[model samples]
Target: MSKNNTKSEGAEEEQPKGKTCFVIMPISDAEGYEPGHFKRVYEYIIKPACTKAGFTPVRADDIKKTNVIVIDILQRLLNSDMAICDLSSRNPNVLYELGVRQAFDMPVSFIKDEVTERIFDIQGFRDIPYNSSLRIDEVNKAVEDISENLKETFKSKGDDINSVIELLGITKAKLPDKVEISAETDLILKSINALSSRLSSLETKNVSFAAPKVVTNAANDISITFNAVDSVGQVVKVSDRVKHFKKGMGTVASIVSVGREIIVSIEFDSGDTGKYTNPVASVIKVINSDN
Candidate 1:
C-alpha cells in the first residue's frame, strides 16, 4: 500500500470500534486487600477479557473528569451497551451501581474473587469466579472464561437472564428523558454555594477565636497552648468526639492526608464507621478535641 494509505489504515486500527462495557467495581483498596490489588485485577484480567470479547471497557474512573461525577456514573450505568460488575469486596458503591444496571434490565457479566461470598439477593445468578492469587496460568484461564462469558452474555441480551425486573414480575425501569437544566436545579446549586460561603466564614471566625495566647507559667517562663478548632476549623484530630448529621456520634479513629485533602475515618458509637474527605467539616460537628 502507499505510505499515506498505510498510515490511514494504522490510524483506523488504533481506534476502538465496538460496544462499550462499563466495569462496575471497587476503584479503591478494600479493607482486607493489599493496596492497588483491584487495579491489578482490572489491568491484567478484566481489560484483556473485554478486548477479546470485542468491547471497549470503561470504568467509573475512566470517564473523562467532569464536575458532576455522579451524573456521569449514573448515565453510564443506565445507558452502557453492557457491563461487568465485580462483587469481590462487596463495596457499597459497586453493589449500588450493579443494582442500577439490573433494574434497567441491561446485559451484564458478573465476576468475583473466589474468597468473596455471593450476595444473598443475587445468589441464583451465575457469576464467573476467579482466583485472586493471580497466578499466570490461572489468570490466563480466567481471561478466557470472562471473555467467553461476555460474548455469550451479549448474544443473549434479549433474554434478560439476570434481570431483577424479570424475576420480580415488575415492569423494567426506563431511562428518563433528557431535559434541559431546570430552575429547581439552579436553585439547588445556589443553595449549595450559599452554604459553602457560610462554612468559609465560620472557619475564618473560628481561626480568629482560636488564636494562641501567650501565658506566663508559675516558673515565669513563656508558654503557648492551643484551643480546639485552631489548626483547622471543624476538622477533628484522631480520637476526637464528633457527631455526624446522619451517622450519629463517632470518634475520629484515623486521619490520612492525601494531597491537599484530609481523609477522616470515624468509628461511630453505633458500631459503624465511615471515611470522609476534607469537606466532612461541613457534615460533622466536633464535640470534643484532643487538644
Candidate 2:
C-alpha cells in the first residue's frame, strides 16, 4: 500500500502546470491612484484570481528586466494561452496590448475599477468591475468575479461574444513565423550598432569628425537596403504603391519583421488598412517601388 501511494504521488507531481495568463495592466502609478496601487491589486486580486482559474499569472515586471526588448513583450502578448487586461485608468499601453491580443482572437478577460469610464470603442464588451477602495470583502468578491470570468473566457476559446475580431467581422491576425538570422545579416546589424556607438561617443567628445558624413551615408544605405527586403527576398518598403486583389490600390504604411515572417501594413485608397505576411507577391503586386 505504501509503495502504491508513493507511485501515485510521483505521478501527480509529474503532471504539467497550468497555462500562463499574461496580466496586461499598469505597472507604474497612474494619476488619481495611490502609489503602488496597481501592484497591490495584482498581488491581492489578480494573482490569486489567476491561481483560482488554474493559470499561472505573468506580468510585464515578472519577465527578466535586463536586456529585455519590445519584441519580447510583443511575443508574450501575442502567444500567451490567456490574458487578463485591467482597464483601470484606461492606460494606452494596456489598451494597445489588449488590442494585440484581440487581433489574434486570443482569450482575454477584462477587469476595471468601478470608477473608470468604459472606453468608447470597446464599451459594448462586458468587463468585470471591482471596487477601487480595496475593501477586504470587495477584494474577495472581485477575485471570485475575475477568476470566474477567466475560466469562462478560456472555455469560450474566442467565441464571438469574447472576440473583437469576430464582433467586427475582421480577419484574425496570423502569428509570426520563426526564422533564423543569416550570418551576413547578423554581421550587418553588429556593424551598424558599432558605428552608431562610435558616433555617439564622438558627439559627446565634441570631436569635429569629418569621417561621420561618409560613415553615416554608408550606414543609411545599408539600413535602407535591410529595411526594403522581406524575408522572402521581395523588396517592399513604406510609401510604395501596390495593388491588392481584393483591396484594390494601396500604399505601404509600414513593414515589421517578426521571427521568420515580415508583415506589411498597407492603407488602401478605400480607407481600409490590411496586413499581409511575407511572400506578399501572392496577394499584393508592386505598382511602384519607392526603394
**What does candidate 1's lDDT look like per residue over 1-291, in tens digits?**
001132333342322247899999999999989899999999999999999988999998997743356778988887778899999989999989988888888888999999898899888788998999999999999999999888877765655466767777789888768757789997886676677667767766644432334434466533223333434544356687988889899987876655545566889999998987653344677887644
Evaluate all candidate structures by whole-model CA lDDT and list the values in order: 0.77, 0.75
Worst 10 residues of 1 by lDDT: 1-10
Task: Kindly give the stretch of ten consecutive residues in candidate 2 with the minimal lDDT sum.
Answer: 207-216
The whole-model C-alpha lDDT of candidate 2 against the native structure comes to 0.75
For residues 60-151, could you state the per-residue lDDT of candidate 2 as single tens digits?
A: 88877322335567878877888999999999999999988888878788999988998988887789999999999999999999998888
**Count of backbone clashes, every candidate in sequence:** 0, 1
Model 1 segments more than 4 A misplaced: 1-17, 187-291
